[model samples]
Target chain A: MKVLEDRIRQEGLILSETVLKVDSFLNHQVDTELALEIGREFGRLFAGQGITKVLTIEASGIQFAMAAGIALKVPFVYAKKKKAVTQAEQMYTAPVTSFTRGETYQVSISRHYLGPDDKVLIVDDFLATGAALVGLVTIVREAGAQLAGVGCVIEKGFQEGRGLLEEMGVRVHSLARISSMAPGEVQFVDHNDPIRIKEKV
Target chain B: MKVLEDRIRQEGLILSETVLKVDSFLNHQVDTELALEIGREFGRLFAGQGITKVLTIEASGIQFAMAAGIALKVPFVYAKKKKAVTQAEQMYTAPVTSFTRGETYQVSISRHYLGPDDKVLIVDDFLATGAALVGLVTIVREAGAQLAGVGCVIEKGFQEGRGLLEEMGVRVHSLARISSMAPGEVQFVDHNDPIRIKEKV
Candidate 1:
């Protein structure tokens, strides 16, 4: 997580107190090696969970989910933001509001993919408003699958996302947790702090 | 590639003459081990090309791009279908019409990630009408980057995608090329055929 925090410090563009863009490496453009390392970290975190699947939303979360799936040696399923023409089967659906895009969209996964037999690990790039993650959690529960907790590449620790998930009794782990950030300076929660570690589970 | 072809034969649903759904493995619910094998296959195909980066459009293409980037040991960038608030910089944009979605959208990549010095390999999940691939090719050209070629997981051989890319003097390699398909039946163009081999490069 230090390497990710360092990269964030070095390359992350902080547009405002609430807007931090790691497009140079994380989302828009990606560092494949770093992504794999993040996956390994997630793999290590949830190694004994017997994860049958990795779940995420489309676009941004696909890479991290794919990486985690690779690390866990399981298939990853991404909920589509919009239902495509081909996806005409029964689906588990939940509405999510994007903090960055400022729009609410329905996220869905085919009923054929998820069932009671599956155990899912949800992964994503950023956990900010927690809206999307909340939506995914709903879908996982709706599918009757066991939740293996959430793994995030980056978490906005100041936001209500972690609080919401914890309230839902979903254990969460973020590789890089940003406590605060401004245009020129950014602060991170000490990843090794006993308090934060106790709160994570 | 044989394994990919076999997966398609076994799991692929032939929805129509034009639509072959491999979402059970390729896109929606991705088989991580198979995806890694795909990456390795792409790596073997474009091994000596000095590919500095792998590129693709967002959503479906992200997984394949990530895999290819992993195989090539390079970074990958995905063109955003919609420009986000954080992406306020100059971008290389191109319009693309989706064959499946029956819509047109502009795909954009930031100016910072691509340049003349970079060699890029564009990867995507499907090569159908070549609309999206053409858009990506235009963006890569606009960035003044050297394009190594395009690698597709599956190609609708009956479609114009390959012809369109070939017309642009671009090399393309698809792991599985489907000649035709209909409900309950699918046929693939023999990969080892000398005529197809000569045309690929």
Candidate 2:
């Protein structure tokens, strides 16, 4: 996490108080080694939880979800941002509003993939508004699957995302928790603090 | 590669003559172990090429690209499917028409990540119409980067994709090359053939 935080400090572009671009490494262009390390960290955190699957949204979260799947030796499923022509089967669906893109889209997963017999761990690249994460949680419940918890690569600690997930009784863990940021400066939540581990159901 | 071929034979759904769905382990729901193996296979094939980076388009290609990056110990970059909010800088853009979605979208990558000095290996989940791969190849060329070749997990050898790439004087390698498919059966291009080793540029 220190490495991630350091990378953020070194290369993260703070466009404004609310906008931080990690396109250089975390999201757009990726450091594969760091991604693997992040996955191993998630695996360690959720170890012994009997996770049957790792879930995430498409586009940005695929890499992290894949990494976690690699670390935990499980299959990872990505909910498509839109239904493709091939995805004609019945699906578990939810609506999510993206503040960055300024649009709401439906996210869906095939009913064939999840069931009451499975345990699911959700993972993603960033936790800001929690819009996409909340949508994924709804689909997981709709599938009658057991929710293990949520793991995130980076957390905007100042935002309402963590509060909303905790209200829903979802345990959340973020590797890098940004306390605050500005045009030229950024701060991270203290690692020694108990907030690193959110409340678990 | 035999393991991949076996998985396709066991779980692949032949939706049509052109559409073979391997979502159970390749794209939607990914088997991380198998993905790693595929990456290792790519690494073995492209060994001694001094590949400084691996490239792919977003949504599905991230896992394979990450896996190849791991096996080769290099970073990977995925072209964004759209112009993102954070991506406000200059970009290398290419327009691709998706036969599956029946729409054309522009894929873009920041100018900072790729350059003439870089040696790139492109990876993807499937090579069907070669629309997306051609777009990526164009971006790499536009960036003035040295392209080692394109590596795909599966290729519909019956399609025009391979011929198109070959016409462009670009080398390609696909782990599982399908010769044909129907509602219940599938055939692969014999791996023992020298044609499997595409003419290198």
Candidate 3:
């Protein structure tokens, strides 16, 4: 996590108080070695959960989900943002509103993939408004699968994302937790503090 | 490649003469180990090419790109299907028509990630009409990057994809080259033929 935080400090572009872009290495362009390390961190955090599957939304989250799946030696399923021509089977659906994109879209997964017999671990690239993560949680429940927890590569702790997931009794863990950020400076939640309540990998 | 061919034979659903679905293991729900193996195969094919980066389009191509990046020990970049909120910088863009979705979309990559000094090996999940792959090739050319070649997991050899790339004087290698396919049968172009002109990896 410290390594991620350091990389964020070194390469992250802070556009505004609310906008931080790590496109240089995280999402748009990726560092595969770093991604695998992040996955290993997730695997270490959820080592004994008996996770049957790793779930995520398409595009951005696919790499991280794939990484976690590789680390845990399980298959990863990414919920499609929109139904494609090849995907015509019956699906479990949930609607999500994107704060950044300023649109609402349906996230769906084939019903054939997840069911009551599965235990799921949800992963994603960023946790800000938590809309997509919440939608994924709904689909996981709808499929009658056991929710292990949520793992995020980066979390905007100042946002309401963690609060919303915590209200649903979903344990949330983030590699880089941003307590605050500005045009030039960024602050992370101190994990070394004895009073820090969040779980550490 | 044999393992991939076997997986397709066992789990692939042939919807028509032109459409074959391997969502069970390739795209939607990904088998990470198999994907890694596929990456290793690509690595074996493109070894000694000095590929500085692996590239692909977003969504489905992210996993294979990540896998190849791992195998090659370099970074990977996935072009975005649409400009996201976080991506506000200048970009190199190309238009692509999706044969499956029946629509055209622009795929863009941050200009910061790729440039004249880079050596790129493009990897993707499929090579059918070569629309997306072509778009990526254009972007790589626009960036003035050296392209080693294009690597595809599966190719519908009956289609014009290979011909189109070959016409561009670009090298292409597909792991499983399907000569033909029907509702329940799929034929691969035999690699054992001594007269085959294509490079075998």
Query: How do all models score by TM-score?
Result: 0.94, 0.94, 0.94
| Pairs in clash, predicted candidate 3 | none
What RMSD does model 1 have?
A: 5.6
- How do the residues A97-147 of candidate 3 rate in per-residue lDDT, one tens digit apiece? 987789999999999899999999999999998999999999999999999
Query: Which stretches of model 2 miss by more than 4 angstroms?
Result: A191-201, B191-201
Q: Rank the candidates by DockQ, best first.
A: 1, 3, 2
List where candidate 3 sits over 4 angstroms from the true fold.
A191-201, B191-201
lDDT of candidate 3 at residue A58, scale 0 to 100: 90
lDDT of 1 at B142: 89
Q: Which ten residues in a row have the lowest lDDT in candidate 1 chain A?
A: A192-201
> Comparing only chain A of model 3 with the true chain A, what is the TM-score?
0.94
lDDT of 3 at A1: 96
Better of 1 and 2 by lDDT: 1
Q: Residue-wise lDDT of candidate 1 within B32-51, one digit each (tens)?
A: 99999999999999999799
TM accuracy, model 3: 0.94
Q: Residues A1-201, candidate 2, lDDT per residue (tens digit)?
A: 888888887788777777788877888889998999999999999999899999999888998998899889999999998988777778899999986798999999988888898899999999999999999998999899999999999899999899999999999999999888766777788844322211111
Writing each residue's lDDT as its tens digit, candidate 1 over A37-121 gives: 9999999999998999999999899999999998999999999999887888888999999898889999999998999999999
TM-score of 2: 0.94
Whole-model alpha-carbon lDDT for candidate 3: 0.90
